[model samples]
Target: MNKPYVIIHTHTSIDGNLDIMDLQAFEEASRQYQELSLDPEKQQFEIQGYLNGKTTTEDNITHYKRPELDENAAPVPEGDYVADPDAPMYYLAMDTRGELAFEENTFGYGGVPSHIVVALTERVSNAYKDFLRKKKISYIIAGKEQIDYDVMLDKFYNLFHIKRMMVGGGGTLNWSIVQNGLVDEVSVILAPIANADPDGHRFFVAKDPYSSIEETSFQLKSVQELEHDTLWIRYSVKKK
Candidate 1:
């Protein structure tokens, strides 16, 4: 394949909601999710990184604070920047508009270190790029306004040599990539409890601008029951 094999991995409720009411169960499920990522036998391919959308990164890492940018700074030379190309693992954040203010270039998951790679668009300010450079973070520009996931994935393979990418989402990102037909597999850790909140985040939500997205289907791949009544389900996206 020209691009990396994309896998959408997440923990969700029985109703396909991202919100789970049981904290204990959620933690257990999350632990299992991490284990699955490291299991050599289960992971036939080397997963170079985990990808997230801008909102998810902000909620979990940045907390919605805007980055201090130099609006009057000199324009940065255009192109992708790879600060640490040889890093073993990565934490790929899809911040199309360069909204994230990362404090560091590395993220830790399951005690394993991963270099941060921010995905940006041409519309981002030069100051944001400079901030990332100061932090030694890697970045890629793939679109003019919105993200062109296809081009981003291509660069991931050609530049960073990321052959297999695991996408850990917050609904909008998941649906966006899947709708673009970029995902290969859907591996979800099904939590036992559900928060029936109508406003709760879902496993996959089509963004407002993606109203014309077609209904996609999946072919069942496998299912395994985990502890605490949690379940692991894998599906192969049915490509057109």
Candidate 2:
């Protein structure tokens, strides 16, 4: 494949909800998830870094605030910017409109440092790009109004040589990549408990009005019992 091999890796309840009912179980499962991401024997591929959706990043990292942008500033040169291509790892964010206000260019994950890379679109203002540049954050421009997953993945591969990428985004972002046929595998750390909240976030959700959910099948690859009654299930997406 010319693009990176994408893996949707997440921890969810047995009912496929993103909410964690049992804090202990969630913490244990999360520990396993981090270990599994670095397990070379289990993954059989080098994981460059993980990707998160814009909303997830904002909720957890940026705290839902807009960056100070100078709309009247001079336009940045066209194309993707590579600030630290030689970093040991990366933390990628899907911010199509460049709304993320990043104060730093690197994030530490599991004691390993990762360079921050923001996925953007042409619709973003020049000031936002300038902000990223000032922070020394690298960014890639894929689509005009929205992100083109194919082009974005290709750029990730060619620019950063990301052979394998871990998709740790929420349900909407997960389903978006899966429906786009860019994901190679699905790895879920199923927590033993389930959350019955009707409004609970699911493992996969269709949020785009223009897109319809297709019935995608997966071939079971492996099942392993983990600590705290959590189960690790791996599935390879069946190509249509």
Candidate 3:
């Protein structure tokens, strides 16, 4: 936790799926989260989706209601829909428990980092806070107010002094951190599978090209295999 250094670690298939089904990465990330998770309900929720939004009279919630991405916002670099630039990081996922609030596909790995710090708007619900807290996780709700990213990064660095911070994200979170040039390293795990859904999230670039690093590079540290014929590779991102 010397200073807030960022590392983007993600696993994707050639078909473009991102889930814990890639056993090695899944087990590694989960072992860490499991060690820290204290709440049984929250841990159970990881296996299922935590309920959000409206509930029916039968105490069941509907699935397949995909939230709309903001139109006024810029599209993702890969040219997919994007959210309001000012919006709290929209997690395009269901809770780990997989209870069903949105789509009903059994995808997503929800492994909590040592500290899952979220930069969200004040509009985030109390239930959301409770859910994270139940897992013994801490959060930073930037509130409806926008925080100076640099200042907030410094605070996170100072607060946790986390030696190595791994950022496992969907897309925008990765883009924002990379665009800001705050990341020190990045690890992209390319799985040999693909998703025919073009609208489904792409690994990185979508439309506009992002800023490039003149000296950005990585050194391979290790490579291993996981259950189900998956692979685990490690790289040390060259520090700028």
Candidate 4:
């Protein structure tokens, strides 16, 4: 059996908002990716901290928050930020499960696992099927009518050669993984800014609260201080 490693790399605010980014937040995420990346050259470029602690915008990224690439396949003409080497295979955009009306997309680089598996239900719409097909994205249906936990894990290890999976959540997907006990660890990067809406969406449970971990605990791994007033802290989840 392959040793599966799970980690959640995320940025949150003091009030638990993970929506938008300021300068420090972006840099910290970039640094984390740089550290986990397999490519050495890309790691060097990302660690320079040039674009550290800045807001992510259209000028810096594409339609999604992905960095805009030039025709030559370079991340940008300005700085040395290189795109993740394994982007094509690993980055997954998770659409709304079953409902084609409001699908979600998640874009990440090489730090993600080998399999970019989207957890979904079986009753997905035709529009979604076409969309995933056109995008050349593979998906897994969990619960009923799709990929369940054991089956998905088997596929991940056997087919995709995935020993580790870093799940960057969009609430529902996060809830799914946590509820299923698929996730083993979580790393939350808390920012200084507070959310404008007190009752707005949070990093974890908002309405349907699940059981908190009983035996699961975490240990501080490391903390990196950036130019901005932000702090990057990593925690290792001590499993039961």
Candidate 5:
């Protein structure tokens, strides 16, 4: 990792559910998320980019044709491509299985930089590589079977020049990064209510059955109230 700092940022209810089913609550949090997210001074890092897990990225995709992978084909040459040197980069998706179908290299988002990068494992097929090569979208590969989080981050640092990235996505992706000892800060917009949904995801979930959340320590960095009674809190993940 060239410049090693990552903040796992999320918005969750008081009860720790990510379901966020209520439309009103979703809209409010989203508004606050944008405000807090773009504030460069507070975060202490100009977010060169951000990330999304497969589920989070796939959820927003409307639908499109997917590419076929040829298992025997050579791996795509390792590299990066920026549409515009100054255009902001957003939503680097962890699509290790080569599942996403991008219509173009740069897809515009609401006032924010609209760009995408597909993170891949070495196992991704050659045909898919050809598809990505044709599309001219940016991509990086890490582990052989699964994405090596550390290597992936290094690619961002070395190739894309992303020093500090905002880890913006679901628990699985967040937890994987945390478990790899890559997370420095746990930032959240604490919603006022304790909305419950048994089906909803938690702030963090361990992959190993024996792994304990209690064992992972954190020191509260700062706390402040936002416009809508939403609390912005930052916790520094304490290392052993």
Candidate 6:
């Protein structure tokens, strides 16, 4: 199946810990991401939407509300229900459990894109469906309970013509994408500090929860130092 080009843009510490927790807020690190990503290489790749996991979306996104679904709610089409991805910027939130609430079609967050796409699963209740319709926010059913990242990504390409996509958020989302061979590239912006959380998360979450750490391969594309003693590195995922 055809898939959109995917890039996971994220930041961490020199020790490779991504969960800054109480040490730094997401917006602050996100600002750092924006600054470091100004590299000509990343800038050249056009992205239609930036994808985020449910937790990160809820934490970083605000100013949206849940309104009652309309009695005259419109039905979304079936059979690989598609839409064009190239028109406007989108913040695709992977909310498989139908737990998110939004007021407008777009998120009110600053800096990042405005348009929002709430990715859902079949298990989402009809009431929630109505809520989304009432809000006029776009969504796609990816699976029964959990999201099928590959299928949804292809849907993004087919419906929206989104050729390039960037996924930035938590380790679970990034690890899932890489584990599924969905990511073509990885961009890491490392803050040169020792803010590692003893019980914090890292860049990539392993596919197996109990498995020991193993070596992964990547071809270094570019490396540089940005302002604030940060190290910006880009690497192409290499299949072994």
- What TM-score quantifies how close candidate 6 is to the native fold? 0.80
Q: What digit string (tens of lDDT, one per residue) describes model 2 on residues 1-240?
A: 378889999889878888656578888887788778855455434789788888788876789888988778788888899998877688989887778887789877666678999989888878999999889999999887888887888888889889889998699898988888788899999987776788998888888741457888999999999889989999988999
TM-score winner between candidates 2 and 6: 2
Each prediction's Cα lDDT score? 0.84, 0.84, 0.40, 0.45, 0.71, 0.69
Q: On residues 160-222, what C-alpha lDDT tens digit does candidate 4 reach at each position?
A: 445665555544445455556666666666666665776644666522332343334567877
TM-score of each: 0.92, 0.93, 0.45, 0.56, 0.85, 0.80
Off by over 4 Å in 6: 20-30, 36-44, 62-86, 108-112, 207-214
Tell me the spans in candidate 1 whose CA falls farther than 4 Å from its real position. 20-22, 38-45, 210-213
Q: List the residue pairs that clash in candidate 5.
A: none
Model 1 poorest ten-residue lDDT run: 37-46
lDDT of predicted model 5:
0.71
lDDT of 4 at 107: 33
Task: Count clashing residue pairs in model 4.
Answer: 7
**Count of clashing pairs, candidate 2:** 0
Model 4 alpha-carbon miss at residue 132, Å: 3.3
> Which digits, one per residue and each the tens of the lDDT, describe model 3 over residues 127-239?
44443333433344332444335644544444433333455555544555566667665655555455456665544432233234343456787676544555556666555
Which residue runs of candidate 2 sit more than 4 Å off their true CA positions?
38-45, 209-211
lDDT over C-alpha atoms for residue 109 of model 1: 69
Tens digit per residue, CA lDDT, model 1, 1-240: 379999999989887888646578888888788878845455533698889878888887888988888777777677999998888888999876888878889988666788999888988889999888888999999888887877899888888889999998989889988888888899999988776789999889888764245677899999999889999999988977
Instruction: Give the per-residue lDDT of model 5 (tens digit) for 1-240.
Output: 454478888888888876655667666876687656654444444677778667766666626456555656666556444433344655577767777877777654434655667788877767776677677777787777778787888877777767678887687777777777788889987777665777788778666531345467889999988777788889988888
